[model samples]
Target: MTLGEGTHTIIAVAMGVDGQEFPSAPVTFSVRLALPAPQITQPEAGSVQDMNLWIGGTGADYSAQVQLLEDFNHDDYGYSLVTLTGGWGRLFNLAPGVHSIVARQTINGRQGPVGIAHFFKVRPSRLTTVNVEILPSQEVKFSGTGHNGATVVLTYVSGPNNKPLPEVVVANGVWQISAPDWENGIYTYSAIQKVSDNAGGWIPSQDFQFSFPVSTKVPDPTNVRASADYSPIFSGNGVTGATVLIRKQDGTEAAPPAVVVNSFWSSQSRQEWGPTFDQIVQVKQRLDGQESEPGVGVVVRIAPLPPVISSLSDNELSPLIAGTCWSGAVVNLVFSDNPAVHTAAISGTEWQFRRRTEFAPGVPHTVSVTQTAAQQTSAPATRTFEIRRTLLKPVIIDPANGGEAERDLRVRGDRSVAGARMQLRVDGIDTGPATLTNGGLWYIELKGLAFGRRILDAQQTLDGRPSERSDPVVVNVVLMPPQFTTPQPGGDLPRTSTISGTGMPGARVDVWLEGRDDFLLRGYPVDSNGRWSSLVILPVGVKTLQARQAIEQVVSRDSPPLTFNVVPAAPYIETPVKDGHIGGSAVVSGFGVPGDTVSIYLGDTLLGGAPVLEDRTWSVPVTLTQPDGAHVLVAVASLDGFKSDRSAQQPVVLGRYEPSIDSPRAGSWVSHPVTFSGQGRLGTGQLVSWFNPELPWAPNLAVSAQGWHGLSVRALPAGGNWCRFQQTIVDGADASTISDWSESARFEVLDPASR
Candidate 1:
């Protein structure tokens, strides 16, 4: 039992124990039961308000209920526990006052006070306001006062239908209410009230309104007109970017406007790339985002020209190497138009043919192959198959009667169109024609054709009647005028260099370093992008540079000259001493270039110091010393700042020495590895040593965690009880051992069955 405020006591009858036998004896002891220092743990409102109080502690008698008095300090302060059980109790719905929590326990007709009392403040009572966010058909989150056990009601009349908006009970303080999928509209909720407020009385607040968003899609295109374009005819394909105009009724092919789909605008015609035709092109076009009617064929697919080589793949007739004797070497003529090459002529000093592996004996040779690709186009690509061999031949040309022409457009034709000396000419330009190649075959090509019409020339000598030329074909030339676009302000040169431009590709585009020599660098042809890019190799002492592209004309602007220093390479030391000694903590430096990496080493051992600075300067203290004797210290530097260099060996005596193991509790089961560790500075040379026990007459033993490490080990044949371990350290020429043969720990390596 406990007193209302002071000390209290408990009484009981008990017995003393003697060999588990109880002796008849009654005893009464006062536990001095203080309600373990009272602490108002919860209700952390900082101050008490209305009516709320919580008192917690230990050591309270479960037999008695606690009593709390309000206004204990005479200043209208009060406290109480109408629902007290054990020592934990909470009081809520309190009045404004300074309150204290006091409890006392009484037992066996005795009583004492509770540990301590507490104070709190409670002002007045009112409702708390909250800004809740949500919509009738949408979900939102909320907490505290009006949550859970809360009855929320929302009222709203559906538009037109004159119905109510669908509502759902809230869960986890979140509710979902949505109207049918709609088009850009707002959901209005007139009134929303929380009937079951977690705090008490019902709370009716304002309603929420939410907006439903609508998305749009692309619309069908109309009134579409075609746009003109140009492209290079690749080796086996022709340009195909021609377009046609389209409209719902009567829109001219030349004039067209854009269309709109849900406020988004799109052009009338859109084009891309597609297949090729016979040395010609087929363009496909359509209104952007619009599908053409079936059978209308309104899309444009432009054909891009094959890659250009600019110049022959690296200058050299035959697989040129260092040697001079190229009697038999296969040489492929180079051209800006390669891979899909259309023509090759074999003649002159380059005639003999040899594979890459073959070495030339003495004479020179050349070999070429002509191939015709079968695809979207009917153009026949020709390559000369020749071998420039010093060895004479019957001049065995495929079509002996037909020889090669001076220009790149010569074609030795075959039947369907056969006849001797077939007159070869296109657009009125005569291409020297030859006879029917050996076997009733004729050869010819469109020679010197004026721009526009493309046609293969007839095969005929200047004297005879010219053979009729193939069907006249239409062709288009690519022209992308290289414009000097003011470059995006060039950042520091290193970031971006060598500019580019466009012009007649394959034409040697000269490059010049403005205000410098012209012969220095001739710019190369612009790449497919109508542009060129190359590194600006600055001369040794020159830190500034500028460049311009000579594509037809200088199309590059002056680049600002920026100054920056080149990072100089560091120096290093080589050659290390075999056996060296250096005082630990002494400045151990290496020999190397001033700006290189220099490292310190005690002979083969490295003291590993921080990298040396640019001045070839580096210093580190060598705190480690060794036993006195003939010892050498060395310093090695490295070429790369990272790697260490060779050594600068210095022979010197280290120190007088004495070293040995101290403690590990002789003959212990070796709980932790039997360590032979002891204190000692570096002598001339120190070596901590341990030995393995012998099994019978055998000397070899397997020690676990070997050398310098105090590791444990088992005898070869497993176990035989008595195990011995030892260690030793040597300094300079002095050596000693620490082992236990007289008193060694005996441990049994239990067998699986025993364990």
Candidate 2:
């Protein structure tokens, strides 16, 4: 039985089966089956108008899915699914005149018998590529024959991740999508037509993927980290020529570690290892490149070293025999920190580092961490890690001051640097400088300067980013006084504690103290902001900020101290601060020093002075005598005699006065002689007038002019006075022109009997 659009009960077993009647009280069918819904995502004929297929009757799917297939190449590949909405599916973009037949739909993990197949020819989609362009908004565009009404999808491919993002709709096959969200990273994107195949399938074009990562744009670089493994090494400061195997990423000898891969042309060899201990190894890639992200990554590996051994001088417990050459037996390797093993079986084994070395004449084999240092990570450490036995003496690195006496400056170092910090002191006083990262770029931000040479020093510790000053590195810095043009600056610019004056081609400028960082870009061009082409964020409040410059690199010089003053941003109320408004009084609080003046207002009227006390509190007495309506109350505060910014408006409701007309009620005609009166807040002196609903406004008539029977009235709280009114109408003239004429008592011919 077919049911209407409403709900209907479906029975697997009939209400009564084979002459056996089932209980009508509660009906339950034991038969379980599913019917698949037909999917006509693809059109059947080349240009079938009203086409439909019965992929499902009652025996198919009990809400099952039907999947159909459409193969452009006719290779017999049809997929299965179940879902059909909208009208019958029709094939699009059909060849001008070619007959094709689709049959045998796949459903519910099974193939069904071929239903009636239809043959038809399809003209190629009228959609011709009129034009494809990149929009100013960066969205790819597509236009063509029928493209005007076609659904288009834009896709982009990224090279760095080797994946493509989901397609986006640039427009409804019309204008352009101004802002494209596809730019999560550097990628190349293009638009394509998302049309249906004539049969029951979807067809995609073999168009070329957009060239990505957009050649002009670079993706977030891939971080590559490379390190070396050694059995034993020297003081790291003495070892001469050393050999390090370059380990690559893909178990090859080319991929290096700690590399920022951003471009397609940036292919590298996977080599594991480099030189060690006072030896130099070229990075093989661009030397001064930056990583995309702030974090470090291991993208490449160096070949495992053949294993070298050191610390032979410390083996005092043993002596050499009359004749013997030692292999790797006496001295063993210990690599618990940054460990490495040739194989999983060799992992954490003593043989990997085992060695045989003699102390001198006669002795027993020895192993001691006391005479040996743990692995040493030295400067220019591309992929090779420092592996020496250890002592408590940590490795210290310095910028240019030999790791000593410095002021208002930063020191750089590497290895075990994460969670590490440096401390700085300017001049002779300790001026807390900027903190540095594990990558070894320390900062000493300085503020407040006196022009001249200043000193800065730094110290560091792990786990905590701070400095107490162990190594004092000297740097010449200065605080240059700020200068501005004569025009009244519309906005207050930041107050910098630096003074800068560039000289001709041959001038020596000396900078010292905490302000030295500003001079780092002396040799380079500068931006309009007066910032050096290579300027970096400098530490604030650094001491001993000074700089000196001369006419030449070695001759007459000028030196001065750096003074900086950054104008703090003005603070305003983020949210309206309101207080209890009782008896027309409210207290407001602001974020500023106390003893400031504030203004209070009710509606648009200013009340009076509301000064903040030492506690930053300002209160004012405000009586809201306003009409019956919502009102906005405003309060403002000022600092240092500067013009104050108004606080957010506070919403409030003014008390309402209920008024009523008491006498000669409404609907009274103008011809009536009725008394008019009302109760209101208006005083006895307030003016009152009579009015009619027919007039645009109540007339301002005098007591004598209103009407002979009506009187001019005033509002009163207790009783009545000229508080009543009465009126009469004259037919011949307009009601407005007829003044209160008591003398004209004739609608007759001078006598009542004359009619």
Best by TM-score: 2
What C-alpha lDDT, on a 0 to 100 scale, does residue 162 get in candidate 2? 38
The positional error of residue 374 in candidate 1, measured at the CA in angstroms, is: 22
Q: Total backbone clashes of model 1? A: 107
Write the residue-wise lDDT of candidate 2 on 1-755 in tens digits. Answer: 43334334443434655677564354433432232234332343444321212222122233333333343434342333322321222122332333444444334455554434445433223222325444322344444333333344545444444334343332444533333333334554454544455456433332333442222122232222333433211111100121222332333434333322222122234332343232222222222242222222233222222223222333243221111112221222322232332111122213222224322221112222211112332221011122221111122354455332222223444332434545455566755544644433444445433334544455565544233445444544432222222112233222222334443223333443352444533433323333321223333222333434332123323334344432322223211222212222333333333555676666568866556666444556555444433456666555454434466666543422323334443333222222434433321212232232222111232222222222323222221122222222212232121111111111111222332
- Candidate 2 deviant stretches above 4 angstroms: 1-409, 413-421, 433-450, 461-471, 479-755
- lDDT score for candidate 1 against the true structure: 0.35
Name the TM-score of candidate 2.
0.19
Best by lDDT: 1
